[model samples]
Target: MKKDLRFLVVDDFSTMRRIVKNLLHDLGYANVQEADDGKTALPLLQAEPFDVLITDWNMPGMPGLDLLKAVRSDPKLAKMPVLMLTAEAKRDQIVEAAKAGVNGYVIKPFTAQVLAEKLEKILAPAA
Candidate 1:
């Protein structure tokens, strides 16, 4: 069921974005989109109906936390599941993301298996 769900992956680095996209592809999720930063992602989120969001915490213009807050505040996008994949492993950051309504958290550098597990856990009920 999750194989067809649209996913938006936001990150500052192109290499990281490609890596995540490839991992998603390996996990059987081919409908994935990429954004260089939260600012770029916001417009896409507002304009499209994405089932899931995978974002990095640190980004230029707007950070993932702010993006999560924005999504949560918008009635149209509030219910979409969000997974935060970032290098920020601090407890406070994780707590902040949780408070901001992120559905899952993954600390980098992560394995494809770990990413698959996180995606499965987040998308399981919907599937």
Candidate 2:
């Protein structure tokens, strides 16, 4: 289902970024890009088209919550599906992300199966 999808992975850690990229690749999404932080991700978002966004909540520059808000508020990218992959499991944080229009959420150290399930659900064909 993800063969034609484009994914943007945002994280402060290069290792984490590579992990997400590898997961996306293993899931059959070959077209994946990486950003070290929300600041970098924003420009990439503006210059390219990504079908889905998987971002970490905490970063040095712009937090993922703010990035989520920005993406949702932007007319051109507002409808893009976003999945928050973060270590922040706080109830309020989750609530905020949901309110910001995140399509899915996953706590850190999650299984690839769980990620795949969320992606499949979010990208399911409209009946």
Candidate 3:
């Protein structure tokens, strides 16, 4: 199931985008796209369907939280799952993301194992 899923990696930093993309690739999800910020991600997500969104909170154009809200509000995209991968680890921010419908939260400087675990939880139902 993971192999068939498509993903979008959104972050202002090219390095972070590459890191997430590579990690997704390593996990066998090769059909992934990159976006610089929430603004860019909004258009791409609307134009195409993505199984999951991995975004960074602090960005220049539109922030990740805004993106999550927009995605959830849009009828066409409301069902898409979002996972935040950012340095913003505050409880309030996490709670806000949860309210906005984020499926997972991963703090930055995280390990590959951590990312994998989150993905598994979102993509695979527990037995």
Evaluated with TM-score, which candidate comes out highest? 1
Give the TM-score of each candidate.
0.97, 0.95, 0.95
Clashing pairs in 3: none
Q: Rank the candidates by lDDT, best first.
A: 1, 3, 2
Least accurate 10 contiguous residues by lDDT in model 1: 1-10
Winning candidate number (lDDT): 1
Which candidate, 1 or 2, would have the higher lDDT against the true structure? 1
**Regions of model 1 farther than 4 Å from truth:** none
Q: After superposition, how far is residue 123 of candidate 3 from its true place, in Å?
A: 1.1
lDDT of 3 by residue, 13-114 (tens): 999999988998898889999999999999999999787899999999899999999999999999787889999978999998899899999998999999
Q: Cα lDDT of model 1 overall?
A: 0.93
The global C-alpha lDDT for each of the candidates, from Candidate 1 onward, is 0.93, 0.90, 0.91
lDDT tens string, model 2, 49-84?
A: 888899999999999999999998899999998999
Work out candidate 3's RMSD over C-alphas.
1.7
Ranking of all candidate structures by their TM-score, best first: 1, 2, 3
